[model samples]
Target: MQLIADSGSTKTDWRLIDSKGKISQVKTVGFNPYHQSSEDITERLQKELLPQITAEIETIHFYGAGCFTDLACQTVKDALKNIFPKSKAEVHNDLLAAARALCGHQPGIACIIGTGANSCLYDGNKIMDNIPPLGYIMGDEGSATWLGKQLLNSYFKRWMPKELRPKFEKRFSPSVGDALENVYRQPQANRYLAQFSRFAFHYLKHPWVAKLVYDGFNAFFDKNIVQYTDYQQQPIHFTGGVAFYYANLLRQVANDRGVRVQNILESPIAGLTLFHQGE
Candidate 1:
């Protein structure tokens, strides 16, 4: 049996596949390395992820957020090794999984829009170069978390319409208490705030929300992606919960930037499964 994990800033997807091209179980867990300590990761893997792997796992491929650094990857590799003693473990960044899911055996640019955002240039099966992922604090425009933050800022600063103010207030009950607690005292605070992006989904047709979405995607393309001079004419592919949900808006944004997007996959599991089968 082989294990493959794809973890984002919010959730993780774990797949256990056999040589017979059969998948036994796919489990999900909340284990974002950015928000959790090493001890916390170990505890969660032991209790939540390892129990599902009842067989003799042969290989493990872990592509996760916050595992970009060599030290971080080694730490996760060590942790998985202790759990799946017989398995050969390798850890990498989640962006590679996104690239594989989006481009597969074809060449293209891949981007992830979730709690945070990131993009990379892929030539068929391998990533050529990555446009520095700035995480949630520095960049990550077009991400659900960033959208939520913008919405909150607009609401609090009275930048939104007067009529929408009451509705927004009623929905979020915008008090200093809720904002502070949710933003500062929560794990995966970006994801916590990103939940509000769904609310914006309902109002996306609204002019203000439309403009906001446009601006978010525009910022993403302009800052991290637009500078890729070599891939200017290449097709762009996207994956992540937000990209899947707001594909129309994303496509429009891409068109405005004079770029084309070929695919928008919600999860990379299907692509990974296909890849493993061919292998």
Candidate 2:
């Protein structure tokens, strides 16, 4: 029996593969080692996850956002160990999770463009290259948060088309002060900003909206993809909401850049489960 979990900034998807190979699942709010302590995670696991499992077994594989450094990874590993003392626990960053899920044992470029943005050059078995994903405020250019931030900026500054302003106002009805407070003073500001992307999704074909999406994706490829040595030769794959939901625009940007894109999955959890099952 084994447990597999894939976590991002907003949610964690858990899969328990029993000895008989049957899988049971659960979901909990996401945790970042950068934000939450081991005790906080343990408490949630005890309250939310422990009740869902009946068969306790061998190992645990936890891939999480914000588990970027050795200390971050250890923080999660300790939390997992505390929850299931007898089980062997392994912790890794979310970028590695995307790599393993999207590329498997084949060499390729893997990217995550959901709440956050990150990319890696994977050489079949390991990540050979990675561009550090700075936060959404400055970097993370291709993520949902990036798109939302752009949309908000455009709407607030009246950069969007004249007619669309009313629609935007009607939908969100947010004032400049309100937007500022949400972004500058509120918690989970990333998620708050990312929500505006859904509005963009509804108006995708609008010339202004399309440009916004395309420009962000163009920046993504420039910063994350073009940095790789064999980026042109490597099949680029993505696993995240932004990639999956805006596939047409993302692919268009890739095509314009003369790069090849292979797979785009909404979540890496399913493919990650398959990968771990094979291992």
Candidate 3:
């Protein structure tokens, strides 16, 4: 059996595939070397994952957020090796997983818009270039966190419609002060911010909300996608909750920018399964 994982900051999707192509799946809390220690990851694996496996694993392909550096990748690899000592393990950054999953053996541009956002240019087999994501603080233009930031800014400044303010306040029950405290001096601020994107989705019919979504996507195209050579000719693909849920809005933004969207997957686990199975 082989194990494949597609992970982001919010959650992980795990697939167990047997030699005959039979597959089973499970979910666990997300792991990031920058945020969680090796011990923390091992404990979660023991508690949430190990018991679910019914077969001996042969290899483990772990693609995750924050595994961008060798030290970070080694940290996760060591933890996995400690548990499944007999299996060979490979740890890689989530971007490669998105590229493999979205582009496969075809060269194209792959983008991710989940709690955060990122984009890369893939040459059929490997990433040719990448624009720094810079996380939610400095960048992450079209991500849920970005949208949430915009929504909060509008709400706090009372820039949204007067009628919408009461509804927003009632739904979240957070004043501008409370929201500021969470964002400026709180843990998991990105996740906290991303939670509000649901509000944006719910009120998408509102002109203000529509404009916010469009402008955020436009920023992503201008800053990230447009920088690549022949980007307009490449098939643009996406994999993440934000892109999957708001596909129409994303496509609209792409259309306005004179680009085309080829695919949008809610998660990459299925494609990752196929990729690993072929390997």
User: How do the candidates rank by lDDT, highest first?
Assistant: 3, 2, 1
Ten residues in sequence with the least summed lDDT for candidate 3: 172-181
**Alpha-carbon local distance difference test for all models:** 0.80, 0.88, 0.90
Error of 3 at 279 (Å): 2.0
Candidate 2 global TM-score: 0.96
Give candidate 3 regions above 4 Å deviation.
none
**Model 2 accuracy (lDDT, Cα):** 0.88
Best by lDDT, which number? 3
Model 2: which ten-residue window has the lowest total lDDT?
270-279
Poorest stretch of ten by lDDT in candidate 1: 25-34
Error of 2 at 276 (Å): 0.7
Q: What does candidate 1's lDDT look like per residue over 48-167, in tens digits?
A: 877676678898888887787888887777777777777888887888888887888888888998778999888887888887867676789989999988888888888988877787
Cα RMSD to native, each candidate?
Answer: 2.2, 1.4, 1.2
TM-score of each prediction: 0.90, 0.96, 0.96
TM-score, candidate number 3: 0.96
Residue 50, candidate 2: C-alpha displacement in angstroms: 1.1
| TM-score winner, 1 or 3 | 3
